[model samples]
Target chain A: MTTDFRSNVAQALKQDAVQTHFRTVVDRLRAHRQAALAGDAAFEQLRNRCAAIRADAIRRLPQLLEQFESKAQRNGIQVHWAETTLQANRIVLDIMQRHRATFLVKGKSMVSEEMGVNAFLQSHGIDCLETDLGEFIVQLAGEKPAHIIVPAIHKNRREIAHLMHGHFSELPYSEDIETLAQSARHFMRDKFHAASVGLTGVNFMVAETGTLCLVENEGNGRMCSTVPPVHIAVTGIEKVIARLDDLPPLLNLLTRSATGQPITAYVNMINSPRRPDDKDGPDEVHLILLDNGRSRIAGDPELLKTLHCIRCGACINHCPVYRQIGGHAYGTVIPGPIGAILEPQKQGLDAATGELPQASTLCGACAEVCPVRIPIPAIINRLRWESVRKNQQSQNSRPVVPGAGSRRRPLEAAIWKIWAWCCSHPGIYNRLTKLATRLRNRLPAGMGAWTVARKAPKPARSTLHESLRTMDIDHE
Target chain B: MNDARKAILDRLRLSQYPDSTPVKCDDQNDPVDPVLWPDERIDCFINRMRAVRTEVHDASHDSWLDILHGVCQARSLNNLLVSPHTRRGAMIYAAARRFPALKNYSQSIEDWKSELFTAVDAAVTSAYGGIAETGTVILWPDAREPRTLSLVPPIHIVLLEKNRIYNNLAEAMRIQNWAMIGMPSNVILLSGPSKSADIEQTMTYGVHGPKELIVILM
Candidate 1:
């Protein structure tokens, strides 16, 4: 029943424990609802400013990128560009080869996962270690992140105890969170001090200054960037903000939305490395700005706002569908409401992970809680249309499986067809509605799929059409 | 070696002036406060250090010492380590005289590894200055002050002068680089406490960094 960290979509769908954990998270969301709603007005204002900043950056992206490259190069930092995941991985590996790095210490970075940096390094006999505790757990379990922020939210303490026991047989089983944390701390301390190269993700890149912002809750991020001889940061180009002054509002909104904290625990801005008079810091710093289909989203009016996402995972925590299926079902580096829409755009709607768009119920909860106010359900619906288009394109000349082919998902098709029919014939619809109202109590159980989890509301005794007719308001 | 040096500078996009002579110091007053800059100007330069979650208060007053003592007691233990900044060391010592329970261990970064790192509960150093827009404290590295002293300790207390605070990060850098005549290799701007949200996204404090930070303004 437990949600195995390494499980794929098919395996996650069958896990009952994951289902129950999601239900619990959804049930507890009411506790945060009041506070979140109160913060909405302030969040909206911040989102508007953030959008302006990003829009401006996008317009000047190329020039800013060139400036950053120039400045970084002048500061002795090697700047690299990768148009695809393969190229990014190769570039990082190339650096490792140049440094003859045996040990790779990683700070928390979703972009690296998107590029499959760990697998690439490990395959080449490089020892890559995750310094972030949540990432370390999933790394140990050989799994992709389930939640963007809290990667192991679906897990209980006992499950972690079991995982730790299996990994460290000498250690005793303990349900205490602190004890488990200490165990991870002890395991990673030596790895960090010994690493030759460190990989990190950039929260924001300053266009004017060419400074890479490293925001985290722990000091490991600092250590990763400073202790290692070579430090590499992987980031999507959309993370760039135009000016340094714009950082505060983004920082404020990101922290409050992500963990309900007023400010981040650590916001380290490194312009360059140790000076001649300086004591300790990385000898070399490299930044790789990735443009892997982000430009396509920037041009689309409907998808443009998706780029405003700070990846705080606030919407994920509040999503009804996400709380049920968890992050694994989305099958992308980022999961939940945001990922469902973004995955298809970045990887194509016909990509093997097409089922992601269908995961949501159009509950409107994610949109309500999203700090940036991305109409997630609307985007998911668009992705569904895109999926349908792709399916139809591939459907040409394929042999139909007799009557079963036409009848596949018949109940769903029939419901849509009926709704379309009702809209077309108002007179017939009115008559049908009145008849249904009279027979509401006598209806059969399980009248629709909705009945599986919720009871159908009792129909009104009479339709508004009937009242209008009685009042002589309209005859047309 | 000469060829390597030229290659390095060429790669860095810097101009090598072999014929240029080093500017000789004209004033015999003090090289530490070079260029005949006033104490007020130096004070203004020191104002760059600002608090993150906490506010910076000048240590020139008596009540400020009480606040420091209160913070020391609240943290449950205290044996302080400070730089050779006479003003900073004096403030702590005066506070200790009032609150005998508190103890002091003052040493510069040169003596960091052997003297300060092992002995102190809190390592207090003067911030080179602060960037107001970023809420970052700038600490310059010196023989008497290694970067490890600021990082390795669990609690970091920084002494910053009010006049040294800059309006934005750009100004802070412009002033700093101008003061040094060239940008130093290390410039660190810290926003808040040292923390990590890595464990199941549950944030815990003091993860491989200082657990606590206190800034003293003068």
Candidate 2:
């Protein structure tokens, strides 16, 4: 299917409510992050340390995965590997079937969202519930998460009140945020108690200790992982860190960057299933390590930076494009600068995802706020080249990215070729420019998408070279 | 599944550089500098906790039970969950008549799941330690005190020793030798009561977990 990026953006831009919501939410988030980081003198050093830690982890990803698997298995935690989302979904289904568990309660897991786990389970006659408040709101509304961290950020309090009232007829309609939250809590309490299995996403996987770390503000994560008999944790393969010591700095950076909190309410570390002597905890802990195009991403040294993202959503909050159009406009799982670079690589360049890279102003705000310091703008430029480059074949060498050069147009290529040729020869360039300058008024005002919201550029009355020569300035 | 593992490992291994040096990660430098004085740490911890809307009460070992009784009476809690096997639980049990009806989490969650989810009014558990920098309480939930005692109840009262407050998470982990000792089934660093800003970024407390977290620092 072709991407409706332009139309989606058009639709999002026209929604005044969404625009106001994005502005208010992102501004508050930006201020929160700034305030959280303001007093710390070591903030820059902490970010550098975090970036290095992630870089080191990605560099040693294969070995770390092996170590984590062995250590986790020794700890009596079952480890599953999935090369694709389909494989991952099947593994989850198989586990649920093995336990005869029809009810699943989940914490906020972007990877599970990547797998479309809820839809997959529901289709198979299983009851899947989102327990995180934001996710629950989005799920109740039959919508995808609008933002990575704040899933229901697109909905205002009034909209949420209506949605909650419509869904839970017993609850009174009130726009009070706390009342709405409490209603959700009351509704989910039974679900949590009844859920046979729980699933969550890993914030970081410590290979040294075989520990799965999850950070969240809601107690739903703890409840889901602890309350259920079976706990399944899913994460991308790249989230593995070499040692446990790497966690504190990364956690510090993540909380500060994500929501401007010194720390979240809960930073849960799961080392194993409940011990035989333990009072309460999951009997079985299963961790799914999903590749899902991340291995290919690691093959390219420059593009490998994409995997270092901690999914803090700080970059998204800081992105100018995302600020105006909001997340839905991007039409990807994770949106803004990070998604622009990631979705294309994961979905291949020829697919609808290829259009995502163009949804940026390359303002460098994302890179600036990025805790791990992924050079998002540089990566965006590289992907743009990868999408439209004419060099599809080069003897024995194959492109690292799938569908590379699929977006190249012969007309655009020919135009660039002519422009290059003219620039090399000054005589033809000077004559052509002079002729164009004389006939500047006859030039069309329209220039495709650029002219849609902007005036088309007109040639100067005289070429720069001619003007310089007339003023007795050096032509060079 | 095994084939998938092998294939993914192979692809990742192929991407590795032949001469990549092991990355040196320096963890010695503390991100948040450790406060030197015990008094400073305690003060900082209290400030941080109170900032997050957590109720912190300074109490002596002898007077903590009285404070607990007052807290229960103030909230009009009908029932409080406690782990009777623990020392503090035993103490509370000894003076059980001063507080509300006391319940022990001796049975498996499967046995008392309904009461724990709906009936429990408050819970009192012992914290492994407190992190001063983030105002976090560390709980290594195990046999004595299950994970849900601190989670399921609407009001969670944690008793933290004054000496156990560390400057930050890294220091706490190191001093406690968490990596060497091996992690419990779950280790929670709780900074505040459960909260969410998901609804239009408006801060809402008690979305899924305990709405009120009261730390009895002794």
Candidate 3:
């Protein structure tokens, strides 16, 4: 519930395992991304195409959604619309209840996490199983997803092995990565077979053809979509694109940026539910278009560019702040620089996400590597400004404003205020400098956190202004 | 549902850029239909696919069945699930007769889906074509070659026609003209075997789907 990032960062850093895991995972991803894009001639051109398509799609979203809905309906796929997470969950549950679905196999859908779909469905007496290995590991461990692409990136192999060993006799405490994968595969494969319905996230919906694309390196996405009698895809309204031609560049950018793969192992373009003549594929396919705070962002000119994000996660991989603490510290469904800005947009600077804007070093790496060219740092700064401005009215005559960086250390603000005042009034400034030189030995103490990492340079006995004046007097 | 749809669309419309003017992307930037020299495409396709641990075999239509037999024999595997409705599946059924050691499963896609999950060792399906740029094998699966044939079993063997290669995904889709007509119910592009690096960033093959993907280029 808390996005008190400073404390979370401190705690995360204290865990040697956490630090090591982040370092290893981010480093590998960084290298992989670099290699994947290295010498790819079409990268920049394709990036431009992707950006253009997103802009176009957002501009014409209503039309595209309408077209997609009609086309999908024609394809015999049922489409549902949800205005909020609660409504979206209800829609999914109603579908499940109608189907008499007991257990569900799920692909990795960040939107599902946003809606708390699993918890909601489970609470309503339907079991939803996460088929993605990372998701499964994290789900069994009773933790929320930590990263967007690799949810269990925070967990080391030994930790994963332990979690699996506790649950399955097949594992019997094997730490080998391959052995662990086999055990999980054996364990989840049956669930896929038994589950009557599959739920997945849509990477992009090609409006022209009414195709829903799900990209994945593991076959779980394919399994979840194909094996089940019923399939439901949950996606935000922002995921739609204008045409099938827009897919190549977007897919290229996504795969390269997310996992540094030339392509995911499988990319399923679901055009419809199983055709009457088709043998395998979902007999009933449903798509839930959820608009939980995204339409407002889309309408906003300043913040609308954020929707251009393909969720490639390159920004997260390249973010210095994200690399330091990993994703879970942010306490949002999506984490890192993207999450920091996006969460505050959905939930205005409240206690839960109030500090997210301040959690950055403002390093522009996230922007540099952002395939969609989102100015993330700019957005975070805007959120910070809004937070501070909002706090101003609340903190009437206070030394510092609440919900602002200056408020955390009011003494620092007071000192700076005094300095500004003295500088404004030359007579007082001269007097203070002379006094400071006179009593240089007896200055204030306890800078606290600042003095911990940084050495305080003792202010020279004579101020720079005083020294300059003394030299001028001597020359005269 | 309709009420929700209208409400969501209205909210989106309200928030949209005031001008209805769409962002104009350069038409010049649009990638054209690709045409590559056959040798160049084949080489590019093989290297890209193999880079991701895919086993790519270059074969003629005459030698493809022999190559398939060799692969199955090398693995000492049996119980292959083939979509008998497909031309490639029929070819496999005919070819598999020579080897009494091999057992073929051809139940209807749903009837044997459970066996495809548990008992089936390998499954072969006919691919629609190949994408040379990313080394992807495209499958427009139907009742004949159902989607599960390529997904469920531990090993997936796809029979891809060589001349059907497209330089990139966009070109392939444009040529397919799915939007103009109608798209297949499921158009899948498989690049390699199922892989996961979720545990310790260690890449492991065959997490939930096929462990091995062998693409036979004919």
Q: DockQ for every model, please.
A: 0.16, 0.81, 0.73
In candidate 2, which residue ranges exceed 4 Å CA deviation? A1-3, A392-396, A469-472, B20-22, B28-36
lDDT of 3 by residue, A1-476 (tens): 23367778878878887877788898999999999889877777777777788888888888899999998888888999998999999998998999899988999999999999999998999988898999999999999988898899899888888888888865577889999899888888888888888999999998877889999988888888888889999999999998787888889889999888878988989988877677678889999999887876776676777888889888898888888888888888999899988887776564567678888999899988888788899988877766645234454443121243422346755787789988899789878878877876776555666676786546687877768787786442
Error of 1 at A101 (Å): 1.0
Report how far off residue A219 is in candidate 2 (Å).
0.5
Residue pair clashes in candidate 3: A299-B15
On lDDT, the stronger of 1 and 3 is 3
> Candidate 3: DockQ?
0.73
User: Once all C-alphas are superposed, what RMSD does model 1 give against the true structure?
Assistant: 11.4
- Please name the candidate that would achieve the greatest lDDT relative to the true structure: 2
Q: For residues A132-177, could you state the per-residue lDDT of candidate 1 as single tens digits?
A: 7777778778787777776666666677788888999888888676
| Clash-forming residue pairs, model 2 | none
> What count of clashes does model 3 give?
1
Off by over 4 Å in 3: A1-3, A390-443, A456-476, B30-36, B100-108
- Per-residue accuracy of model 3 over B1-218 as CA lDDT, tens digit each: 88899898887776665665768775686655356899899889999999878999999989998998888888877667775556776777676665323334434556776666777788788788899989999988776667887788788888888888889887787787756866678888989889998887888998988899999998
lDDT: worst 10-residue window of model 1 chain B: B25-34
Which whole-number lDDT from 0 to 100 does residue A21 have in model 3? 79
Misplaced by over 4 Å in model 1 are: A1-43, A169-173, A389-471, B1-122, B128-147, B162-193, B196-203, B212-218
* lDDT pick, better of 2 and 3: 2
How well does candidate 2 reproduce the true complex, by DockQ? 0.81
